[model samples]
Target: MGLESNSMPKIVIGDFGYTLEDVPHLSDFIPDLPTYPNPLQDNPAYSAVRQYFVDYDDTIAQNIVVHKDTPRGIHFRRAGPRQRVYFESDDVHACIVTCGGLCPGLNTVIREIVCSLNYMYGVKSVLGIHGGYKGFYSKNTISLTPKSVNDIHKRGGTILGTSRGGYETKKIVDSIQDRGINQVYIIGGDGTQKGAAVIFEEIKKRGLKVAVVGIPKTIDNDIPVIDKSFGFDTAVEEAERAINAAHVEATSFENGIGLVKLMGRYSGFIAMYATIASRDVDCCLIPESPFYLEGRGGLFEYIEKRLKEFGHMVIVIAEGAGQEMLSESLNQKDASGNKLLQDVGLWISQKIKDHFSKERKMTINLKYIDPTYMIRAIPSSASDNVYCTLLAQSAVHGAMAGYTGFTVGPVNGRYAYIPFHRINERQNKVVITDRMWARLLSSTSQPSFLSTKDVVEDSMDDKKETPNYALLENGFADAHK
Candidate 1:
């Protein structure tokens, strides 16, 4: 067997399908492989020999290589070696900007980026853009160094500051060109990624060679394909604290109910995870799962039954939940153009109060809590700090490798480059049929059929209505059956 210093070990075939003679030599394919500088040479964390190029034929089991279209578009392969970098460390100028609302790991990401670029790549000219996209044109920049961002990850929020609704593509591109920044890192959510795409297109239109990279920053964990977004773990952890407080307040009084509103405009991951973590929540309301207010088998009826049995109940709700139930027109939008959802927590509290006072002639104690901003402004958890570091490192690696017009995130359980168009293609919503939802339903023991279709079917049933007391005494399963 031929032994190469920086290549895969040669294996001898005995009774296997293929023999050593049948395999092609690596030298035949990569005769003149370029030698790239190894920054992490002293560190044992990274492998010395990196797989720079991957062959699709090598993944096939057959002896003959077939070049046919696969079902999933492409075969899986590891990233090749890092040889082509767009910027030279000594002369390159880079800018980092944050946009959208606050997330737990925003500062952590910024710190990691600056540290990696300064230490790993020896980049000297690092500038921080303040106030999101508007800062790009307004020329609000702060000089960054390894020392300046060393302790930023220990704090919450972003040192560069952040905002939304400033998407001047032309002016931003002009500013980038004027500053001679070859690489730009943008950290934000869906709207911010959209803005990055526009800025990238303008740069390309002007025939400029600027690499624009995005770090997917959303506490909602609504970005698709990726397993989870940074700061999401911290948000869920903090939201659990609010849920705990709500539980304490609810259980203190007779027939009391605690309602908590969490951040998740188009998704429900935060509410779902927080409810699961708290384990004391009796009901969970999310944007994906709609619930009814007044009916034979509705939320009000369920609450009445639970209160009768358990005396008190704790409920967690996403901000976007039950907006359709509200009669008021939703004409307002925030700086990022996201529709301002109705206050579902307050609405549910009021509805419960009105139903008990007028319909049942009973008094109900409900505590309304909105912990959206509180959760967003806090520092990141230990889990998120590690996640934010990996995300930032992967982003810098991709940006250095001459990859442009893409975002860096974990795809298929590995860190890889994802195009901006694919990142913003659609919103990632909670799958109602998935195991997560099933676990939530099993834990809370809430009515499974809060959906509109289920409510309509129940209303259309000609069977006699079961008594609320009987349903409470038995279980929801017996009542449904």
Candidate 2:
């Protein structure tokens, strides 16, 4: 239940073209480290409360075996208590920077990091790096103190601001050296973490003792091995409002269809969960499930059948879903090198309209709602605030403990330090075969497959039979045909 027996820190060789020789061993520079001072060691109040700290079990147990090398799986130890830190209080100078797109808990994480470094470790020289990685070389920094970041967590967004796509290695290291900053916390997503790994490798190559710790920040919740990233719960909560609005709009009019697009560049957690939470969604589409447009049991046919059964339908689709259906090129990328996904919501809406107009000479009123910016700009929810605070505290603990080239996140249901190499190995996507997907299917009542031989054979059997227009007098046949 504790990582103490197998608490060997592993050196991770990053995927940023760094070889094994480039990484430094922990024993090389940090041998015989001193334990953190116990301020409560001599206090009379400590004797009564000492059992709380001594018997604490913050190590998380894995549900299944993650790797063959470790049969019991990986266990993440809590980063405080009697653990020794590599940096001295007055000698330590730390920097915090936020990068990538906006998430709900960025400001909360920043505030917690500043507070932890100042109060817990008594680190005085904490600096807020502005404009992300460029802030290092650009000399845009604000001196951080306990008073400066006191009320920042009350608001949303980062106090230091954020940017993307500034991974200049030499200039960043030179600035670190010139400014005498020994510890750095980079908060962002996958691309930002990759840049952090490169920066750490550069620091090690220069033989500097600077520690780089990453705090994973992605609203998409796509980081590998992390149980849930900060801002995801808030995003899902905010997205529910949009889904509810769409449902109201769809059901208000005749033959109404409300199509909503949420953020999920490579994965579909937001769309999947929002559909489950909203409960009014007729169909849910995501990047994990490939959907077709005009087959026997395709999306269009499903919508047509739903309209016939209930006069209206609500669809929730992730941003990255149905990208293959787009005929245009997606060569453009954002500042973080992420591919710009095509507008699938608009495309689907237009396609549905055209299909109804051209094939059946019928009109379908469809409304498209894109609430991506609104969801990402909101403040953190109550759950995300707690999650972000814990992440920040753990990150500061890792940096103080001389752990570098790693990200601090909740892994296997516990807050743990995850190496960057493992993060970049693969993307975390929703498994369509999982219980979550099964729940989604049950909630939406959508068919699992877009096309099937049985569906085609049944259509062929229907075509072979004589036409039955007895219900045409009731106006149902005219409305559909």
Candidate 3:
């Protein structure tokens, strides 16, 4: 008896099973999925995995209904009618895992999925794929039961565990297929999501109908349309809290500057949003704007003046802020004679305070603080409660609607689906729109302390006299101005 289209798998919050519609294989859904060059056609790792896949296929592929198609999520198909159910006591199973840098509210996502899926549709066989994609192939999985996952709602890190690496191999797909893992939920940023797509393609080729769901998990909150990634709010709150504490210190001393850096690889959402949300920040440096170049001294000078006038300064910088504003007095270096660039937040603070102290002969004390791991991993604030739960519920809804190969991003404040593979497409870093830039420039009369024209330049031969303010008045440098 095949799963009839009319009989959708009924799913209620307290019910016993999820609603699944037809799911197709790659050739049926999107024929253009990249066919990888089978590097290890018969390697032991590949063989073992492939065998596992085929064995499972043999066990459930025929007469099993949901077992014969590809794991392309909810992509449309033109082939014969697809299997319409996800959890067949004989086949369907679910899983999740975390990977890469930590972000806030990870546990909430895991807890919601486990509880909802278990209670709603009896999709009780939820496994945690340990160590990201690597754990998938290594097959090091930890099972998550309703009981085990109950109290995880208030947790911070991923309870499912995570890894950072995996290989693109048929064997890996086959192993998963053999395990009856019909669906997988991955929580991570671009890299991990891209890996999920790769695995989806591989299993699709073999015609095992598995669904792959990706949750955009990054503290950077740079992923498009998601209206703030899972951990961004938490990270920003923590950063602001730290900045406020630093502000108190700066004010108490009546003559100090605090430079702080938040994480965002090539984006400025964290730095920009935190600065706007938390009013204590005097200046914010983001990858969207030039940091360590010439013409970038204005902000530093402006902050210095503020400290001199108002008694304290707080500057928020992105980790990827270019290495331009280093002062000649502070000795900074990396192993390669590169401008020693860790703790960029601190570097900016030091450079600005140093400029005023060295030039004005004022005792402008400085403290450089980089809350790299701290901000990212802080327990999510109360504000995250609503958003985190909503996002996790959204993923579940997307799955129930038979949607796949799409990312659920926030649009006009509502979560909407975007082409899923775009998660890895790497949208260009957010450029400061001319209008926004003008508003920022006009909003305050604070002139830039450092020029934007110069980046960090350290004399490789000598260690002293680092970070000089080179006047670089140009388009890129205009960000600071």
Candidate 4:
């Protein structure tokens, strides 16, 4: 029902190996900012709580599983209510906006933000900015209240609506200033968060009191620094239905092949997790792990082997997988500047048919299923609903307590506040060498799809590429210290 800080102490082991940066605050730029007792201290809803405020020094570690001799690494400020707040209840005018693509828990986050502000802090003047960042400048604002968004969480998509690539920092901040809006809640994916960071810089440059907070929204679960994005569980759950259908269709006919495509533009969490859950998939392909079609230890050879043994097989692939193998060159991008991906599911389906009917001189039945939209438009699962509620409430508490230019999400099962740059800089990808991938390989008994040269090159690249953000070892100050 409520959230608390992990309260991990900052431990610096070496001189040049670790850095911890804190999120910006209204007081950071403005001088002598006044503080008031948190409104929650008087609210009957939180009265029974023993500790109403999080410690200022409370933080969560970024790397929890390092070796005993390794450094403690980075830590983020814990997310919760602060004993003193900057804005008075009646003085706060907040607005919520959802950008980029649709995700399952968008409405849940929106509902919780409005409800928390109204019931928890008595901040009734909440406005919903329609149609992404452009809404701030072009569209009329919709007044939001606890009653207005009561049943929204049961539905899919954001009630405020969403879009992409309309981020003009000056105009959006102008709208905020003109309307006297001090709190801004932005919900979107990586690109949207990048835009949010720009907006925060612009606000700080203009000396505005606006608090810009981001809630990372991606069904792909690619946003880094968080355990998983909010709607990832729901997406994985919905993807299983498609995998099951593919399995039935494949098993029904002789030499049948079921090919299912799920969402994962850059990361393959959906396809990986969904395939593992189904336990019927013979192979799972993602962007992180390179795959080949021909030659020994190739996808085609594996498919042939599986078909020979089982008479039928299922394959699940992420949307972003197998781009290099495609004959067609799709050098295009969408509104958010994400590359338009060629359909790997269809390509592999055709490839499989050709390899059997044309190359191998054998007949094979192939079924292609693309349930990307269906999975993206459904309501969140029970667990996701609770997770979204916590994220939204933590965001509200942080904004009320004057934490600005940050995003809120769970780190190691504990909620924490992170700077926008830390998350937007790089994505959280599936590690091929990790235990999870090993488990998937063990379950499917599929080849790694990696050659000796690929393995050597990957190792060289890992050693050569300096981790600018992974450890945050350089170019940032130790804000927690």
The TM-score measured for candidate 2 stands at 0.85
Question: Candidate 2 residues 1-481, lDDT tens each?
Answer: 1101111345323343222211122335656655555433433645576342322335443333344454443444444433445677788999999998999999889889888777777778999999888988888999888898888777778888889885677889899999999998999998888888778777877778788888888898888767888999999999999999998888899999999999998889899988998898989988877767877667888899999999999999899988987989589999888998889888888888999999978778888999999988888999999998989988887777666777877755566666676566567888775677879999899976543444566677877663331211211111100
The predicted structure with the larger lDDT, 2 or 3, is 2
What lDDT tens digits, residue by residue, belong to model 4 across residues 313-422?
99999999888779987999997889998988888888888888989987788999999999999999999999999999999999999989899999988899998877
- lDDT tens digits, residue span 1-481, model 3: 1111121222212122221222322335444433322223323544565222111111111111244453422211111111232334324487777876677788888887777566543466888877766776787888888788777766666676655544544665776887877667778777666666666666655666566667777777666534567777778777777787777767777587776777776677777767766677777767666544223345545665686678877777787666444443335543212233455655555556566677667786676677878876566777776666766655654454344544444443554444444456553354564454334434433333343323323333344654564323342422211
Q: Positional deviation of 77 in candidate 1, in angstroms? A: 7.9
Candidate 3, position 316, lDDT:
73
lDDT of each: 0.74, 0.77, 0.57, 0.86
Backbone clashes, candidate 3: 53
Model 3 regions lying over 4 Å from their true place: 1-90, 169-171, 291-297, 324-341, 357-359, 428-430, 434-445, 448-481
Cα displacement (Å) at residue 467, model 2: 23
Candidate 1 residues lying further than 4 Å off, grouped into runs, are: 1-81, 450-461, 464-481
Cα lDDT tens digits, model 1, 1-481, are 1111121223335332433212112122324423245344433445554653332223212122334542222211122225445456776699999999999989889988898887777788999999898998888999998898888888889999998884677778889999999889999998888888777666655656667888898989888656689999999999999999999999999888888999988789999999998999999988777667777668888888899999999988888877888889588998788998777778778888999999988778889988888888988999999988888887777666555666766655566556576567677878765678889989999976444454566567854665222112111211100
TM-score of 1: 0.83
What is the C-alpha RMSD, rounded to one decimal, of candidate 3? 14.8
By TM-score, is 1 or 3 better? 1
